[model samples]
Target: MKIRTRLSLLFTLITAIILLLFATAIYYSAAKDREKEFYSLLKKEAYTKANLFFDADITQKTLQDIYKNNRKILNEVEVAIYDTRSNLLYHDAVDIDMVKETPEMLQSIHEKGEISFYQGDWQVIGVRYPFQNEYYLITATAYDEYGYTKLNNLLNSSILIFILAILVIFFTGIYFSKKTFDPVRDMIKKAKIISASRLDLRLPLKDNKDELAELTNTFNEMLTRLENSFEAQKLFVSNTSHELRTPLTRLLTELELSEKKQLTNDEYASLIHNLTTDVQQLIRLSNSLLDLARANYDRSKITFKTVRIDEILLDARHQVQKLNPQYKVNICFDMETEDDSDISIEGNEYLLQVAFANLFENGCKFSDNLQSQVVITNKEKKIQLTFSDSGIGISEKDLKKIFDPFFRGDNKYFTEGNGIGLSLTKKIIEIHNGSITAQSELNHGTTFIIELPI
Candidate 1:
């Protein structure tokens, strides 16, 4: 069953149970009041007969006259008088029904002094008086107290009415349930139509400030983000193919022209050298793409070998100095702990070297070769490598895109770059679970900062 249906049914069941209890209480209360009224009438009739006997004017003629005067109301009742010896004194026994004149009941009446009730096809309450040494039996007919057959019939009819009410309530509850849940169903249907293949489709939102409307808005926002990412991916692919193809086409054309024409040895050598440089740059581009793709997929497992932070920095500094002898390189080590500590991490060694190499290369490329410098700082849990140069600095906007694949910040310095070096470097650091950032002043200098966990 649906949730709303079950909720309605539960509500109805609770209401019905309460109603049934209330009906039973009311029925009994009405029955009790009716029974009291019947007994009151019987008592009143018994006292009247006692008054007649006390007045000593209860003659057969007077009794008959009094009975005729109240016959309309008293015909449904019975009046009887008896002696202490069980002998009837003044009673019209033939007028009473035979079913009500049972011998066992009569015996109890005699023993109990006054009859409270007399059983028959109809309900009656009886009372007795002991005035003037006489026994009196006064009974009044009552429908609420004794009419068992009629009571049973009324009960069956009431049960049928209750059952019919429940059925009506059940269908009404189901209808209300469906009506309430219709909007939610509509939202689900609309959501089914909006997917990656149909990003233009938007979910309909209502003006109401409810959770469903908020959900619709959130879904729309998610779809918008996915569409933007997909568009960026397409543009990236197109740009990358064009950039790589230009050099490849030029190399192929140059080799073909050289082969078809006679050329001097120096000319041929120059063509071969140019072709080799293009091939090497293409190979580097491919490798950088592979590295970036690997970063997108997974990082390497940590192999925590105890490494000296000072040694790593010194080695990087030496490598940079050898690459650019005209520039000055400075290394600083701040050892906050004793030796043999785990001043190392479980990481891919080769990836870390690539990151350091990128920082050094960026410094060389951007530095004016006079004040070019790289600083290495180390402590307990982290190492910070800074490379500062007095060359041209990056613009604020270009700083963010420098690490993007095939991104170029300098058109002049990029004469030898396929623009994948810094992208590969960032990917390598990320694989080592580290960070690299750039801070630069336009005219004075540029700085590259790297932080890696030990």
Candidate 2:
């Protein structure tokens, strides 16, 4: 069943049960009150008859007349009077005795003074009366027609009201439940209209601070991340195609030119050297792209271990020097104590090495001295490393876009390097829960600072 219908039914069922119990209680209480009132009237009639029978001023005819007049007030009312010896003295009916006078009954009435009970449908009350030095027993019985009629009418009315109340509660539940889920319905409608081409669209937020509003906010935040990721993917594909096409085009042109002309050994060797350089450039670009893609993997799936930051730097330096022997990397310690734990951090060792290698290469590639200096420090429960190089520094405008993939500064056009290094380096550092930032000035060189939790 739909939520609205289920809620409505549940609401009606609960209200109906409560109404049933309440109506039953009211009817039972009213029936009890009516029975008590009828019994009271019977007891009063019995006492009056006994008193009048023993009165010396009232004659027998006058007593009968008084009883006949009062009997008309009660329905099916019967009165009987008896002496201590169980002899019937006065009977309300002329031709028959409605109540049987027994010795045990008179004895009971004398002992208890008064008692009330039911005889068939009649309410009976027996009373013990005292006249001059003698006790008499008097019993009266009556059927309360008016009381029963009123009780029956009340029961029927209560049933009718109970059914009406249940109906009201059922519809009221449906109305309120629909009102409550109206926002969710609107969200579903809006979401249906949003596709990849329309990622900029967002769900409208209400002014209230409720659960539905929080849900809308969370969805909007997710949409923002998805839009950013899509844009980044498009940019990455565009940049990759452009970077790859340059080296491939150069290689193709070189091969075409050599095939078209008869060249000397020196020309062939120079052409071969140029082709090798282009091939190497392509290989490096491909490796950098792979590293960048790997860095974007989910962190939870990656295995991390406690690896020393300084060791990663040393390994990166060795790798850089092995590839380009002319490049010089100097590592320095600026802290007071060289504690192993202080320099150790939880991270994927290979990714950390890649990040450091990129930074080292970047520092040396831009510097005139073909060298970079890396200083390590342990402070505030974190490992801080600074890579400094005395290069023909970056302009302020270029520095801002340095970490953007394939973004080379206008001043560094003469350098033979792809701009993937810094961007890949930043992604790797972030994967290890670390941060890297660069500071540079024109002709004053650049310094990259990295901080990682230990």
Q: lDDT tens string, model 1, 241-353?
A: 97789889989899899979999999989998989878877786676666556555544344435555556656766765675576465655444556445356555555555
* lDDT against true structure, model 1: 0.65
TM-score of every model versus the real structure: 0.56, 0.79
lDDT of 2 by residue, 1-454 (tens): 9877898898889889988999999999999999999988888877777766677577767776766787677565678888878887888775645556578877999899988888777788889888888888888887788999999999999988988888888889999989988898999999999999999999999998999999999999999999999988999999999999999999999999999999999999999999999999999999999998998899998899999888888999999999989999999999876468988999998999999998888888888898999999887998899999998888899989998988888765758777888999998889888899999988888999999998
Score candidate 1 by TM-score against the native: 0.56
Using TM-score, give the best candidate's number: 2
Cα-based lDDT at residue 394, candidate 1 = 80
lDDT of 1 at 309: 51
Please give the lDDT score at residue 339 for candidate 2: 68
Task: Please list the C-alpha lDDT of all candidates, in the order they appear.
Answer: 0.65, 0.87
- Looking at candidate 2, what is the lDDT of residue 228? 94
